[model samples]
Target: MMLPSDFELHRPATVGEAVALRAELGEAAALYAGGTELLLAMKLGVLDYEHLIDLKRIAGLRGVTCAGGELRIGAAVTHRELETHPDVVRELPGLAALERAVANVRVRAAGTLAGNLAFAEPHADPPALLVALGARVVLVGGEGSRELALEDFLVGAYETELGEDELIEAIVVPVGAPGAVYRKFQVLERPAVGVAAVGNLVGGVFDGAPTVVVGAVDERPVRVGAEMLDGAALDDEGAFAALAEAAAEAVEPVDDLSGSEDYKRHLTGVLAKRAVQALGDV
Candidate 1:
């Protein structure tokens, strides 16, 4: 498959301008950012659009800021940018590590986090961690702006709740957690399973049930509450293994090229355990 050569590219300099283009063009146009996923889909003939609204030139949409216990990541912020951003490194190093391991260096340098969520690819890593961290997306359109939880925004594999006339403005992530960890198992281009665990530790002991999300094995990230780990010591292998088993059972993994259902389920457990252990080490 090859990209259609006839599609017109429209450059928008502002969020308002981008919204107007989206409203005017409707289904005929598609938002263009990093082009990491969109352009590939076009080339593969999976999507067709008569217009491509280029948003690279849009001002006020390419920086990251930390305030009021959260991090605001602009729509145009790329994976590489997030991986090394000072605020991200200092405040959310787990996320920075996750961003660093996204696909490869080329994709990291060119792919935006907003684009990743908008594409909603299940095998991707960010969604699981971001969802665990309680992230939200800010969307703008002709009707103005609205915010949606990352979990709610992503409907399923290759799908989202984004309106046809709306564009993602930024991703907001809460900044405080005792610590969080993300771990994944990959054999091909994408992971077979990804797990993220966020927990609060009080004086070196688990204070509450941790949030463990299993991704890449299902249509969307599956959030599993690790109640068994509540008040368990970090080195409690029995508790961590129980959490892993629960996470594996929580996801409805499909049989695909990534692996058989059983294979992915096993990977889910393995990664879930690793994620918890990693969080404890932090």
Candidate 2:
């Protein structure tokens, strides 16, 4: 990789300052969290900016905690931090496991969840799982803050609803959805297709209305309801096959180095079945 072209840098001590700077510089400025994604894209000549505003210096933009019955994760919180944090372990164990499965040790060490989501990488892991877990994103701009559902925040491949002057402040996930599972099919550590299934455990069995999301095969996660699984038919192999086919047909997989569109569609069914089975609602 080569160095990106010259650009100015600013370290903001507060999120307000970061938003203000972005507003002041307009499209020339980029609010940077970890730079793991931004810098790499710049090196690839896919993205460029004249100014970088570092969010790491902001005091309250890092950490994991619980309040008001939701797990509040700061935008600057790295994957490695979430992977091992005690609070994350107790509150969102499925997410912790997913974090462990991120690219590798070095990427986990440097990558932030907010950065991961904001980049809106079609092949990334967090968005599907977060969407299944009913997560919400907190975005801040000069106008103050607004919260939007994770699925709504994501618009399409490499695109999002994040305003030019807005920065992700935090991600909030609902508590007590213990039966959550993440499963993925990857080649060379990059996910080809991923599935996340989550639901409440009622009386030792998963609730009937589980949320199932398929990712990496499409621009964003595509959710399939448990109704498609058919509780009575879940016991039959043919029924499960039908369910898998339905999920595969639901996504718009693209051809890439990881696999062809057909291969991703096949993986989507296989992984979605495995993920939901892991959650035991099947």
Candidate 3:
């Protein structure tokens, strides 16, 4: 990888200062936390910002805490933290498993959860489960802060709803969902297909309005409709097929190193069935 254009770096110790610098510099500036994504883009010459506002020096933005019925994950929380933190492992072991399976150890050590979501990489691992978990992201800007559903926050591949002056604050997930399961098919660094299901147990099966999110096969993580299986389930005749087909139909995949659009669409169904089944197993 070669270096991109030169840029000035500003280390800000407060969110206000970081947002202010971003607002002042406009689109020429970007808020930097873990450089895992931004640095790669810079190296590829896809992004070249004139000013980089480093947010690591800011306080109160690097830990995990639970309060008021939600797990508040700081924007700077690394994948390793999600994998090894005692609270994460104990309270949401399924989610911990998902984080553990995220790229390589080095990337896990350096990549922030917020960075991954904000970058909105098509093949990234977190979005599928985050959507299934009913996660919400808080965004801070020069004007004020506001929250958005994780699904809405992720607008498309390499894109988010974030404004030039905005910086992600934290990702918040509901405390207790019935049972959540994440499953994926990957050839190398990035997932080719990923599916996650979070459900509420009603009458010994996931009949409640369970969330099913499919990722990597499209521009963004897609919420698979489960209305076909509302009362029916994996064990029921035609139920699994309907559910899988619905999931596969929901995505419009772009062919790349992962596979062809047809192959990815097929995997979407396979992974969707397996993931929803795993929810029952758990």
Candidate 4:
């Protein structure tokens, strides 16, 4: 393995210790969750860190539980765990679908939910699902712990609100928000041109006016509000059209090797329609 220059490694047993170490090291240090993203960035020279804090060995940071009518997932929980966990499948099938839809089985086995969110790759799938679920990220740092809505935590491509000393501790997702559905469109077996879409439905109506989020198109996930649907009924045609319009208006996707802006825009409609249709069936 190729190691970056000026590299130092530290394993902290507690979140408090990790935060203190990060503060001492300042920007020269980076947190290592699963090394799925950080390792790649280091190889590409996109990241420069003199110290690496390993959080995997930390106790009480890798479990799933339900409390206060919400699901709490520790940051260290891997995609494979989420995919196979019976509780997750029963509570949030959309999340399980998104987890399975991530890059291959190997990536799922090693990749952490917090790592994926922290990477903030436009092409990643988890962020969109979490946003649609109205999840909250818990952070621990030198300034003490704080909780931020998933939307507020993610700012732009490869950017987040996490302070240098802050590390995500867990994610809290409210239960009974709405029944949700997720859909993704990929090219061959490569990364998706368009990732997943989640829809939360209420008593014959869209919950909280419904929410639609698209990923892998831009820096961060694009969230579409129910108002964008213009009060369309949750019927097949109405739900489909609403999602289509929201996808187009909500995202400002860029052209890349996967496809063009126009192509992605069109997929926003295509996938949105599929997602709405799926919701209607359930």
- For TM-score, the strongest prediction is 1
Candidate 1 Cα outliers beyond 4 Å, as residue runs = none
Rate residue 139 of model 4 by lDDT: 92
* Tens-place lDDT digits, model 4, residues 122-172: 677788778888899999888788999998999998899999889999989
Residue-level lDDT tens digits of model 1 in 118-236: 99998899999999999999999888899999999999989999998999999999997668899998889898899998887876678888888888888999988799988998888
Q: Write candidate 2's Cα lDDT for 109-220 as tens digits.
A: 9889999999999889999999999999999998889999999999999899999889999999998775888999887667888999886544444446568899887899
Model 4 clash pairs are: 122-216
Q: Which portions of model 4 show Cα errors greater than 4 Å?
A: 1-3, 188-208, 228-239
All candidates: TM-score = 0.97, 0.94, 0.95, 0.90
Score each candidate by Cα lDDT: 0.90, 0.86, 0.87, 0.78
Model 2 misplacement above 4 A: 200-206, 230-234
lDDT, candidate 1, equals 0.90
Q: What RMSD does each model have against the real structure?
A: 1.1, 1.9, 1.5, 2.5
